[model samples]
Target chain A: MKKLFQIALGIIAAIGGFVDIGELVFDTQAGADFRFQLLWAVPVGVLGIVVFAEMTGRVAAVSGRPVFDVVRMRMGLNVGLITLAASLLINLITLAAEVGGAAIVLQLLFDLNVSTLILLSVVCLVLVVYFVPFGGIERIFGYLGCALLVYVAAAVHLKPNWHEVGQGFVPHLPSSALYAYFVIGVIGAALVPYEVYFYSSGAIEDRWGTADLNLNRANAALGFGLGGILSIALIVVAGEVFFDPHIQPGYLGTTALGAQQAFGEAGLVLALVGMLFAVGGAAVECAFSGAYTLAQFAGWEWGKYRRPRDASRFTMAWLIFFALAFVIVETGVDPVLLTEYAVILSVVALPLTYLPLLLIARDRTFMGDHANGILGNVLGWLYFVIILGVSLAAIPLMLITNGGSV
Target chain B: MEDKQMDLVYRVLDDQLVDIEGRRCGRVDDLEFDGSLGDPPRLYAILSGSGTWHRRLPRPLRKLGERIFGTGVSGRDVIRVPWEQVEEISSVIRLKAKARDLGLGQGDERDAALVAKLPKS
Candidate 1:
């Protein structure tokens, strides 16, 4: 049971981050416009994430340094500072979005005003974070996020075509403008850069030495791969219920409702629980990643394990950033807007964050005898080009498609 | 000569620095060169802290750092170590300079800058 529980961590972090606001919207949007045509992107993204995440994990385990620590050391202070600021901005924006997401969920459940719920959500997150010990934070957030597996169960209940679904294993793009837009949405979901930062930093915090190298590989390959599966299930459920009816996946209510078509009332409850965990985990991650980037850059003592007094600067940076996100969400800004914007920016920031890991992972000087083997180097370079391509494509697609609106 | 201990600059260049009794000081930020007659040019002092970091920077970065760090301006940002004083380096370090003796007691120099800023309740 302990071994099983330990293995659950990767799935949990992936679910919390992937099934969170950005993904719930991205998958649903693709389901409505393109149906199973975009399903291929899900596994494609799974492969992409698995490649880079494993590299990041291996490098961290071998080097005894987290992602940002290496970035600052190898890339020099100036480039590190620029990337740090960019990553922090993405984290803060995602934090605001998660706060807004939780508020929207409350609005659905209690019939309360979203503004009031936003404030309440902010307070709740802050309190949860305040008493949360460093070691326990990841576990709690990850486990709770696993409740998102309900969407998978619901998709199975819908009895999606086994034959057609298998076809997605091969890449095939639809010629329609709407389907092309959906492909972009899928890429956005699969390659979000924050996942890289959070996962690699987590590896460092746990101090997984070279002995833990296989553990790192297992975590990345299984954990993120499972999250990608959950994402595809969400898309299937949306395709079954909302596709023919012209319903779009824009709000929290609609996403839960789509699952209801398959699993009935119980599905709704599980879906909501999943949403709760997803947002909760994402919130904790973004807020902490914000702090991690800054502390690592300035070479301050930082981590959740350390006391508030010991890591004062790290603690204060996150506390202030969390407060700022709370304030932003407290305004009437839509969580959906925040989520979509965050995902796009996260994709755009992809190459910047991953390139350093790719370079460091393959660098013989840094990794010594433990450097990425031929297979890792090939996969790493493939994802490097893919990430660069997507980052360049993001802004133009956002403008040309007007944020994927057909 | 290999049997004898090396100077802090010669040995600890790009190495982490610790206090006299052994605590983290930071890193070797810059080295002071004092080459005089008849001595194999020994390092006179070692620099640590943002002050030494500033000296190593291009002019623009130095200005930006000065602006952010409140322009105390000069070598005070660093703690210079004379070679005779360094102890040893390992996982942790032992230094010849005490926490207080290395200008730390004046403003508590050896500790982290953020810790120094904290007010006692």
Candidate 2:
């Protein structure tokens, strides 16, 4: 019973930590643009995240090292610096968006102004990070985030052709310029770089070990896999309700309203609640990720398991980022546009961080008997190439389409 | 060493330093080399500062560093060590002496007065 309880908690935390603001925006955008055509990317992304997360978790548990530390050791600082700078920019943009999205959730619910909503969101996140136990942070987000299942319920209620949905399962090309953006959106939503950073680092903070390797695998598969299902549900909801409405999803309000369109009052309430939790959870993770990456790379004390002053540098890094990101929102920028850009930049930053992780996890010296097998190596390299391709084209396509409006 | 290789030092030089107790201090931002280049070149000091670091960076980065930290901050001087003092290398650095007791806090003054740094044999 005790063992079962532990696994349940693990699963819950994984679920809560899995989805973020990117998934919320991109899933809805894909649905609005190409209906279920881009849905296949979610599963593809889930598999990719699962494989990488497993390797990263194993590396952390077996080698007692975080991914950033291993990156410096195996790939050297030049490459590591490039990845850090890229990931840092991507994370900063994401922090702004999540903060903004969470505020919007409050605004919709209470009819509050954007500034008041943002301030409350910031304070709420700080208190969560400051006071909540790390274990609770994971589980609360996972379970409360189940509020997102509203999208699933909404999809079921709409009564789409399940056969047609299964047919869209086979990957197909997007037909137009906007089609590329939809594909990018799905990719961006699915294979976010920060997810791996938070997951592996969290495993280290939790002190996972060789004994827990299976637990790590199960968490990655189930957590990310379930997040993938939720993502597709959002896509289905958007496709069923908004595809005929001919609305392109460039804003958060459209997504919120899209859910309301699917299930009326109940749908709006679920979307609002889910958005609050998902965006709130994501903001906390991204802030900590800045601290984790820097401290892991430089070999400083880190993690929420440690008190703030105990990991002074680590705490400082996140606090500084949180302050800067909130300042960006305060400058009155549109958070939705900011998120679109963040997704694009994260696409660019993905390969640098992921490639070294693949290389090092396969290294016998670090991982000992737990090093990657031949199959792991192939998947690692294949994903490396795909991430690079997506990154290289992400910006140019955004420009060509003028932010996907053309 | 090529001057450019010296510049590459700032970027390439960062490795986590741990004391004998395996507690992290910081990165080895700069290396203090014994300039008495009579034999095969000896690395005498491990420097850790922007001024010292700038001397080992690309020209652009060096100038940028200089612009930010000033030339004095990019000074060649660092915590020089007699290469023999370094005990071992592993996941963490294990120095023979505690960092504070060595008057490493006092900088070059104590290192100059007490210990004559010998080149590696």
Candidate 3:
């Protein structure tokens, strides 16, 4: 029963922690525009993340070093510095978007000003980071964010045609540049670089070792698999309610309306609460990812398991990040637009973050008997090619489609 | 130990260094070697810290790094762990000495001191 509870907690955290402001925005937008045509991208992105995340967690558990540490060692100082700069920039933008996202959710729930809400959100996050243990933070946000599962129930209640939903899974390429843009956006949103950084570091924080290898695999598979289901649920709900209405879902409030359309007041409440926790959880993830990348690259003491005084530089990095994000959001940029830009930019930088993990994971010196198996190598290289292709095409498609406004 | 030979670049350089207590010191940023040009070089010392890392860059960037880190041309800031101090070489380089005791963590100590001064919430 104890082991079952542990697995259950891990899965819940992954599912709830999976959908952030970017996934919420892109999945709904994709559903609205393509009406389930782009659903194929969700699993592709989910599996891509799982493959690398498992490798990262395995490397951390077996080697006792996080992914970024391996990245610095493999890429060397100069190239690693370049990668670090790009990742930090993307993390900052993503963090700002998430803070803005949580603020918007609060504003929707309370009819409060967004600026005040942003300030409140930043304060709350800092306090939580300071006061709560890492495990506590994960469980609180994870369970609360499960409220988003309401989307799945709402999708089921709407009873869409089973044939069309199944057809959505078979990959079909639409000729429109806009469809291509959404495809890239949906995939990028699913496999954000920070997820691997956070997961690997989280493994270390949780004190995982060789014994936890199966736990890592199970967590990545079941947790992220369920996350894929939630993404698909968002797309399905949008298809049923917003497609015919021609709603673009340009706001968090608009995404919440899908729940209301399906189940009225109860759905609206659950959706808002779930979104608040999910986006709040993302804000924490991005902030810590930024800190972890910097600290691990510099070989500084890091991990939420350490006391604040012990990991001072790491703590300072995240605190400074949150303050900067609050300032950005206070400038009043639309959080949804920021989410789109962050996702696209991160996709462009994905190869730099992931390639090193693939290399080091396969290096027998690091893994001993636990190195990448035959299946791991096959899928790792396959995703490497796919990621490279998408990365090269991302900027051109975004430019051509004008951020999918076309 | 002398019979066990491995590629230093692949096995030693860039790997993390952990001290006797299992605390991370840093990565193997660079290395020092001894012997004449014609003879096979022997590992002499393990170089670490930002100074050594900065020196690995191209000339202009190395200058910029020196300016930012305030490292001098003599490279006094680099922490040199004598090769004999390495107790084991595996996934990570294990050092026989404590990192703090070796005067290798001045920057970290300073940061901790500053953070300690901040009021607890």
Candidate 4:
């Protein structure tokens, strides 16, 4: 049971990184627009993240260092600094969107003032980070974020055509620029760089040595695989509920309406509560990820296990991130729109983020007996090539498709 | 010294620096050597902190880093731990003493003190 609970780290990383406010709506939008045609991207993304996260987690456990440390040591200062700068930029934008996302969720729940709820949510988040232990934070958010599984129930309740749902799993050539954009967006959203940063750091925070290799694998495969399942359920729900060509699942409330259609008020309540924790978890993930990258690069003491005074700069960095995110959201930018831009920027940063991990994980001098075996190498290099290709196409698609508008 | 067997750039440079107590201090941002032109340059000391590492940046970014992070040390702006103090050369460079005793981790200590002043931190 204790070992099973260890998967919470993966759950939080996956649910928070892959199914956050931005992704929840983004997946729904894909379903509403392209229906099941984009379903293939979810599993493709799930497999990609699992492969990299397993390698990254193993690297951390065996080497006694995090991903950024390898990045700096192998890539050297020039390349390392470039990675750091790009990561921090995308991290800040994503953090801001999450803050706005959580605030919007709270306003939906209580009918309170959006700005006031924003401040209130930030204060609560600060206090939670300060007071809660790392494991406690994971359990609270990781388990509650499962409230989003209400979408699975809703999808089943709607009883979509089983044949059509299965067919969605098969990839199709893009019929239009907009279809291509959603395909990449679905895959890229699942492979967001912050997920690995948060995942690998969380492994260290949990103190897993080589003895915990099996645990790391379980966490990576099951936790993220569960997230992929939720992504599919969400798309199925949106496709079934919002089938009309005139309708668009553009807002969080509209996304929740799918659940409402399935089970009425109780389903709606569950979806909102689920979103509240999932998006809230993403806010925490981004803040910690930003701080972890900086601290690891600079070689400062870091980890939530340390007192605030112990990892001083790390503590300060997360605090400043929350404050800056609050300021960004207070500008009244739409959280969903901000999330779209953040996802695109994250895809652009993906190759830079994963390259060092791949290099070190495969290096015999570093990983020794645990270096990438045949399967890991084949998958890692294959995904690396795909990421490079998608990364090159990401910006151009966003411009041509005008952020996935049909 | 039998330095020919070791690849300093790949094995040592930019690796993590940890003190005896297993606390991370910084990275080997730069290195110093001692010898004349014809003599094989022997590794002399390990340079750490923003003060020395910033030099690796392009001239413009170096100046920008200096402006933003400041030279990490006062006066010469270099914190050098003699090569003799490195206890091990594995994934990390383990040191023979505490970071504070070696004039390292000053920023961490200073920031920690400031954080101590905050309420409920």
List, residue by residue over A1-406, the lDDT tens digit for candidate 1. 7656666665566555566677788888787776677888888778998998888888878865567766665555456657877888888888998888887777777888777887788777766766766557766777777777888888888888878767755677558555665676687767766677777778877878888887787788877877888888878888878888998777767998876787788878778777876887788778888887776655455666655555666667777878899888877677787877888888788777788788878877558888989999898888788778778877777777777775
- Candidate 4's residue-wise lDDT over A1-406, tens digit each? 7756555665554554357865686789988987777888889888988998898899998887788998898889889988999999888999888888888888888999999999998998888887888877776787788888899999999999989889999988889988888888888878888888988998899898999888888878877877888899888998888866547867767888889999999999999888888888888889999999999998888999888888899998999999999999999998888888998888888998788899889988888898999999999999999999889998999999988875
lDDT head-to-head 3 vs 4, winner: 3
Q: Is the docking of candidate 1 incorrect, acceptable, medium or high quality?
A: incorrect
Poorest lDDT segment (10 consecutive residues) of candidate 3 chain A:
A299-308
Question: What TM-score against the true fold does each predicted structure earn?
Answer: 0.84, 0.87, 0.96, 0.96
Residue A135, candidate 3: alpha-carbon lDDT = 92
For candidate 2, lDDT tens digit of each residue in B1-121? 6644533342335655555544444446556555554766657756543344455556677777566534533233334434465676544445676544432323322332322331110
Ranking by DockQ: 4, 3, 1, 2
lDDT of 3 by residue, A52-89 (tens): 88999999999887978888878888889889999999
Name the Cα RMSD for model 3: 1.9
Per-candidate RMSD, Å: 4.8, 7.3, 1.9, 2.1
The lDDT per prediction is 0.72, 0.74, 0.88, 0.85
Whole-model lDDT, candidate 2? Answer: 0.74
Q: What does candidate 3's lDDT look like per residue over B23-117, in tens digits?
A: 76677878999999999988899887777766878887887888765472233567888999999987788889998876555556667887787
The chain B TM-scores of all candidates, as shown, are 0.60, 0.54, 0.80, 0.82
Candidate 1's displacement at residue A406, Å, is 3.8
What DockQ was computed for model 4?
0.74
CAPRI category for model 2: incorrect
True contacts kept of each: 0.02, 0.12, 0.45, 0.77
